[model samples]
Target: MIDKVFPTPDEALHDVFDGATIMFGGFVTAGTPTNLILALQRRGTKGITGIANNIGLGDKLDVLCEQRQLAKMIATFAIRASGARQSLFEEQYRRGEVELELVPQGTFVERIRAAGAGIGGFLTRTGLGTLVQEGKQIVNVDGVDYLLEKPLRADFALIKAFKADRLGNLVYRGAGRNFNPAMATAADVVIAEVEHLVETGELDPETIGTPGVYVDRVVQCEPVPVRWYG
Candidate 1:
């Protein structure tokens, strides 16, 4: 039985270094690993590359971009109407201080999962009709255009969950079940931050979103402060 538990978010994320590539779990405000994200920001490590579904949701991840700790961002979208205000992201992109790699939401998840599974790459028709196909190998499968998309692996995966056991089995609550599971599988090291921490076997087997095998560390997150994006 592995303890795999940490009292603080900072401890769970202690070994993250500068210039590392990280995959953050979330789909906007839902299931975002905010505690670990904040700890990373507070660490002030620079030149980081992050992959997530989106980059805003009130006070959530916007802080990272504002501090310039991020060197590049790969995601589907940056919040324009809501969340942490994409002003920082837009400013950085325009100045060329930060690079952005836009990806389709579904493809992003698949790429990460493929990386985790040790697969080289897979073909997809998601970007067949647009610029997403540019610079990528194209193949015809059953007379349909498919683009070759590479797997996405990360040095660290920051995942959030509604609950977890000391052994690192995770259970996500409702909308929080978006990208956290896939991100968890795709990282060399997985750090999980949960709102509620329980003893081993406390969580039902069927309810676990991510198994302990993928998780390396666990942290109990404190209540997040409320911030309005509107």
Candidate 2:
């Protein structure tokens, strides 16, 4: 039996180095991997390229961006809306201090999924003739033009889950399931921060969303109260 469990967040993420690309799992802050993010932030590894739905809702709590830790962010939303708190990422990006790749929401997720699935790239009409198609290839099949969107693999994936068995199988609760599963398969090292760390057989096989084989490390974290809206 493999012991994927780690004693602490630092030990689990000790190997993460500078200039590594990381995929963050969450829908804004709802199911964010706050614990793992904290560990990485403390490590102070620089030149990171973060892939996420958003940087943060312009809050001081976003240490990764606030501390100038990321060299770039490949996300759907890095800038906040009017009257929203402004995050440090926006400040840096606007001053030409950092890089930003703003992908269309659907295209961004699909790219990550494609990487995990081992596909080179996929063609989509989502960004045809738009800024998203600028440097990408354009393929025409029949009469429709599709933009070639590349896969988005990462060196590490930090995900928050509800429960994880010793074998690394994970069960995410509610909204946490959003990007965790996909990012799990897309990264070389997947360190999961879960609320509950159970023994192998303690978990019901049917409830697992991310199989253990895809996860390399698991750390226990306290589950926070969360509510979802449709």
RMSD of each: 2.1, 2.5
Tell me the TM-score of each prediction against the true structure. Answer: 0.93, 0.93
lDDT tens readout by residue for model 1, 1-230: 68999988888888899999998887766778888888998888888998887775543776888689888899888636444445677677878888889998888988988998889888898988798888999988889878999999999999889898989999999988888898889989999889999999778998898999999999988758545444
The lDDT per prediction is 0.84, 0.84
List model 2 lDDT by residue over 143-216, tens digit each: 88899999999999988899999999999887668888999999999999898988899999999999999999
How high is the lDDT of residue 131 in model 1? 80
User: Relative to the unseen true structure, what is the C-alpha lDDT of residue 133 in candidate 1, on a scale of 0 to 100?
Assistant: 82
Worst 10 residues of 2 by lDDT: 221-230
- Candidate 1 residue 207 Cα shift, in angstroms, is 1.0
